[model samples]
Target: MDLKPYANYLRAGSAMIAGLAIGLLATVLSLNAGYGFNSLRAGPWTSWPHIGGADIDPYARAVISRSGEAPLGRDQGLAFIARTDSDGAPLDGACDYRIVDPLPAARYWTMTLASPDGRLVANPTERYGYSSVDILRKEGGAFDIDIAREARPGNWLSPGQAQRFVVMLRLYDTPLDIDSTPDPNSFPKIVKLGCA
Candidate 1:
């Protein structure tokens, strides 16, 4: 009996398996850059509903473990991330952004701009984030931050040269909990300005 037919079938099966492996790898990489399926939305930002908790799903736990960064404990704080502007456009370094309006209830907070990989950007401005103590607030707990490569007065952040970026918001000592998520409207808004 000839073995040609069996060998051909084996080759086809191997190719299919390889394709599936590559697809899975790509998906995991994408998820590593963004939040997993347990994402919670707050206006333009996204967060892990199970942050700093041990009960996170397998995918979320994998991402957190692989990153090797310690998330604050449940009673410590919560972190939110935004990959797009208010219009649902990807945050681009070529464009400008305005983070404005009321923020969530917290004793203190900070806003940071980072790369898709969550690494701090390198720019001449040397500004990485804006803290509640440093920010200029308007009446009624409102504030505006200008995000661009160029110079701006008041609160400002630089995205460096990266084309795609993400913004991070950290709330310290907030009253919110896992079961009680306040309305997203209470969070600040990130609006994209004209691109150069």
Candidate 2:
């Protein structure tokens, strides 16, 4: 006979459930979307300099904790990732690509192919990436790295069977100015050659 009390309880319970659901969704999305705050973008490459520093934002800390990635310290260097080509196209393994270089000043650097989630893409060569010390260079110090399912002539990187991938570039002991905008021209360009 007293249905008003039951209805109020139901309404309160529904509101609490909805609030929880929305809150959880937001957290998940923010964490997965990217490292938070002060992202530096040059061409297709992006890096979160603050994420590697002691003053890192709360959201970035949370992301690093969840991802279990040991970010480079501020004094050590910076890490950048290119999920898209220089023309702003999402990197697809079906398409062949060439990374043309005029890399920023660094004591050392590395370029690697990884799945979007950061795992190395397995291939027949069993090569995940190349370091500055090992990458083949052209005359006068210029270089190009080719990415495809089939082999190319020089500086080849195979994406294997992965349908999608990202390029990770780490500059160790770099002299780059994090306080200012980096030159996009200095960073390498990912050019999509063609698709299968």
Candidate 3:
């Protein structure tokens, strides 16, 4: 006897559910979409300069918190990550690669290998990274870090059993300009050698 009113209520309920679902999806995607905006990209590397500043955006804050990463303060330094090779290929643990330096001007820097989720790779050497002072360099102050599953001479970093990895480069007390785009050539190049 009151079917018309009941149908109207059902239609409204369905629409409300659809709206909620859409809103939630949008929020998740936005937050996970590359650490907010204003990213400084150099070749395969990307840095969010403002994420460490006082005026950090909500999207950046949410991402950092969700990932459990404590970003360096703006005055302290800047951090960059490379998920791909110089040719724009995703870093694969099955492949051997070389990280060659032309690093930007900084008081100090460190390079580390981590899983995509930010955990250090479990290698037999128990070494996860190298700092500026500790990394092996050539006669001209140039350096290279070899990434491979097998042992390598000089500076080497193994991805261990990880199928994929990311390279994190952190600069401490860097003088590089944040207002302008940095030269991609100045940043280290990840060159893929061969694959297993």
The top-ranked prediction according to TM-score is: 2
* Distance from true location, Cα of 76 in model 3, Å: 0.6
lDDT by candidate, in order shown: 0.82, 0.95, 0.93
Worst 10 residues of 2 by lDDT: 50-59
The TM-score values for the models, in the order shown, are 0.85, 0.96, 0.96
Candidate 3 Cα outliers beyond 4 Å, as residue runs: none
RMSD of 2: 1.0
> Model 3, 85-145: lDDT tens per residue?
9999999999999999999999999999999878998999999999999998899899999
Candidate 1 residue runs with Cα over 4 Å from true position: 4-33
Query: For candidate 2, lDDT tens digit of each residue in 1-196?
Result: 8799899999999999999999999999989989998999999999999898888998899999998999999899999999999999999999999999999999999999999999999999998899999998998989999999998898999999999999999999999988899999999999999998
Clashing residue pairs in candidate 1 are none
List, residue by residue over 1-196, the lDDT tens digit for candidate 1.
9999899999999999999999999867865655466666777787775757766676666777778777776688889888888888888999999998688888999999888778998888888998999888877767899999898888888888888889999989988755655687888888878899
Every candidate's CA RMSD: 2.7, 1.0, 1.1
Error of 1 at 134 (Å): 1.3
* Candidates 2 and 3 compared by TM-score, better number: 2
Alpha-carbon shift of residue 51 in model 3 (angstroms): 1.1
